[model samples]
Target chain A: MKRKEQKTFIAAFLLPPLLLYALFVLWPAVNAFRYSLTRWDGLGSATWVGLYNFRNILARSSEFMPALEHNVFLMVVPGIITLSLALFFAYVIHQRIRGARLFRIAFFFPNIISSVAVALLWVLIYSASDVGLLNNLLRLINPKHEMIAFAESSRLLWALVPMIVWSGTGFYMVLFLAAMENIPDSFYEAARLDGAGSFALFRKVTLPLMWDVLTTGIIFLVIGGLKIFDVIWVMENGRPTTTTHTMATLMYSKVFEEYNIGYGTAIAVLLFILVLLATMVSFRLLRRERLEY
Target chain B: MQRMLGGAGSGLKYAILVLYLLAVVFPMVWVLYTSAKSTQEIYQNPFGLPAAVTAPSAKTLETPIENFEKAWVGSHFSSYFVNSVKLVSISLVLILLLGAMAAYVLARFEFRGKGLVYYLFLSGLLIPMQLILIPLFFQFSDMGEALTRLLGPITERLGLGYLTVSLHDSHPGLILIYVAASLPFTVFVLTSFFRTLPGELREAAMIDGASEYRIFFSVMMPLGKPGLVTVAIFNFLGLWNEYLFGLVFLNSDHLKTLPLGLASISMQAQYKSDFGLLFAGLVIAMVPTLLVYMFLQERLTKGITVGALKG
Candidate 1:
């Protein structure tokens, strides 16, 4: 009876937070799931479309598969490069080398920036004109080939690629850096004396141990990759045949701009499921007993 | 021989680090330079330094005077700014105070459905903002309309002219969204900070007859300064650059925040590129964040690493 009463007592204190959170977040979350089932605009009756909304995106829309391919391509190449760079930078800094604090701050500053702002900056950088940063730099060095950063569709892809990679490397660096610091130094010291060189030491020790954090980073990048709407949305606003379009931007264009609520919700719901599945998989596979060493 | 190679390798490593740093920092410097230059000169020489800061000098600056002045004076940018500051400040303070208090209750005291409550908050961290935006907008609209209707009847009953409460464009409306979006991470972050506090510290305070409120306000609040600073800065930047919600919520031209304001006014000529005004506006819009970052440079790193990584 005492235990039950104590539980009730604690429940009273926890009530307010739970109520507010559910009312705002959980309620909306239910609405998101529900709305995905219905064909609704910003107004009017939501028709019960059943599995059609899901089916439309999965099997119907022409942009669906190509955009998925683009998002997946975005996820793998830049994702792997940035994660490895972050891990490397973190490892170096965690070694307590000189100017570690400064390096960390310089790297992590980009995380605070809005993706819209970064997109704006990178647009200028990749401008097809000679005023663009990369083309000018290229002109300055070689003065040959007049590299078209944003002229051709393929060129635009290559142009925006650097911005995506450049902006995100710092965020993952901070994550891995933290994980590295949490690893016991005694293990590192012992590994050092065992005649393990830098790459060998990292491969055997750091990567295996920080696997949990790495998986977490990968999952984050995957979801983040799929949700690549805002930056792309700001730059060109899903323009020129929608070649650069991802699922997120496609949803936005169809729904808000084109007023295709049914199709947009269909895409948004697909992204949510795909992201959710990726996160669940990462969590399931990567979790292990906490090896506190 | 291996030692010699290791020495060369370390030297190469330094070279790579310097190259990486230059790559990141160079574009930022270009922004600073471009912000000072005139449009005429930008076309002729993209790489030249600014001859003057403001005009009427040896060299002229060539952005539209109207845009910068418009941002500062014409538009209620000052008012919109205050709205943003007040919204962020009030929301963060409330979240920190209430969040830390609730975190204390969860961490120190025995609680029912605690794990469930914890996961309830944790699940929020996974939810990206794009998903729930539609439902939230509907809720906000409904609440706003309901408040307006209530205010109308009350005013009429008193025989006064009806002054409808337009909660839609009000400061409180923005604050509501900010709080909802920010509370999850703030709670997660402060909970960790709270758990690190020694249990005896609070218990001993309790023996001294300190109330829960007092223990929280007096003891826990002050010690959690670092964590508070971290959360505060993150909240500041997040709210500052937040456009999607701001775009949806704020409709009046006079009520526009910096980001939306810049986005609307800066681009012209039927999409004719005005890199000059755009860069100037971008620089101006980016200033508060840059300044905040420069100040919280070290603390921000520690906070994000600790706050975000554990999840």
Candidate 2:
């Protein structure tokens, strides 16, 4: 091919995707910053209030504070449980336990279900009515037991812990399992010869070996926790209360429902900043001396 | 003493694993059987077998069929399913083709600003979609008005009716966002994938007098199947279950995708206390991806591992 023709080919190949990406993604992203600084209802002429929205969000009485706290709770509570369970499962499965494949496949089932569907499934499970699974089980144990409204907004955050762990543990297990499988059996044998117990062997041999993937998994969990929306939205019936709102849900309601476009976009901006900082901080904290086999 | 301790530990491990397995699998099983019962029957025997299974009668057997019927047609889950299929399929095709083209050029070809262009796409990995959501909502309105202005005179001159172009509340609008939003990860993954392919194949094809386009179409694309499949599955899952974008962009009842439709139905079901329809709807929303996962579990796991490790 001629040099000119090669240039033409490259132009043709790259331009469409680049153009589309810039138009829809990059352009809006830049505009989000500009929108954040102004007061606009999304329909009328806008007034630039320059950081007032940010100030409002940062106020002690602002809804954003509680929402941020909920995000943290979701992140820390479920995040810790999911990681521990995944690591345990991955290590056991890595040891070639019976039905490892079945466990891996079945545990991953909930992860593939749509979050809305998962939330609905859990709603049925948590219902206070006669059809509620958990309540029914409680009734089985004690016929006089009162039903609990597990999906109610006041209790929704705690209710979400099991659901998040249930859905998330599988993916991390598979991730850590893949990393564990990459470690040669020779490493385990060497550790065993050194008189390392099973627990010690896993600690010394497996965890450090899969540190990079573990870091990746933590980052995924943090970002997922920060951006939780669908399940909360579905569970709260699309009207998440101040008690139950995450940053993403709050942003949605502020903008779409209340037409506080500037304030909502500002929340989104702060959410982005939170995600960026969380990723960086996790990377920094989780960065150990990379262990190689 | 040591051996007995080890035995207890192993038993505990099995117990925990089995318990978790039941916890995960039982809810789904419950949903399945619960869907086969009427709302009244469900209240009576939440944990028991539906009458259809325990003691089948003509009327009892109709319960399962009727639930599915009410969900699939009455609640418009069938429409939602079809919309999801159409939207996801079209977006997948465009994402693959465009992603491959850009990734191929960036990976195989040496050009000025190559690093800059590649990094620009990579930067998208850090962008939260929420940051762009608000601006894009308004931008669509602006774009629609501008497009209508541009085409209004031309259409008028051509004797066509007055033309209006809107990106809101339409499938095309959502498809555009899905394709564009998906590209960053797609390009990042496929670029690395393309680089690993033998360069000699492209050179060999070129020596045979094939044009660049022909080489890409005939030689490169066929070889890119494994990479394409991985990208396709990842994007398919992401876009298929995508909720936030669909919720914002698609408002019309008929135009809503599965997740949106499922969400709306769930709210209504709660209000109506219609557990059967909700369970049936949940099954409708879940079964396709579940079926696909059954067939492609290995590939799907491999894809996630590779993506996680690489990204």
User: How many clashing residue pairs appear in each of the predictions shown?
Assistant: 0, 0
What is the C-alpha lDDT profile of model 1 across B1-311, one tens digit per residue? 12222467667766776777887888878876786655655777887775565344632533445445544665445665666666677888777765665676777776557787787888888776767666676777777688778888888889997766655666677776677777788888878888888888877997998866677779988988887877776676777777777766788877777766655644341165556656666667667777878976777777766666755
Model 1 chain B poorest ten-residue lDDT run: B54-63
**CAPRI category for model 1:** acceptable
TM-scores for all candidates: the values are: 0.89, 0.98
Which segments of model 1 are wrong by more than 4 Å? A1-16, A95-101, A144-156, A238-241, A287-290, B1-5, B53-83, B163-170, B269-272
Error of 2 at B275 (Å): 1.4
The DockQ of each candidate is 0.44, 0.73
Best by DockQ: 2
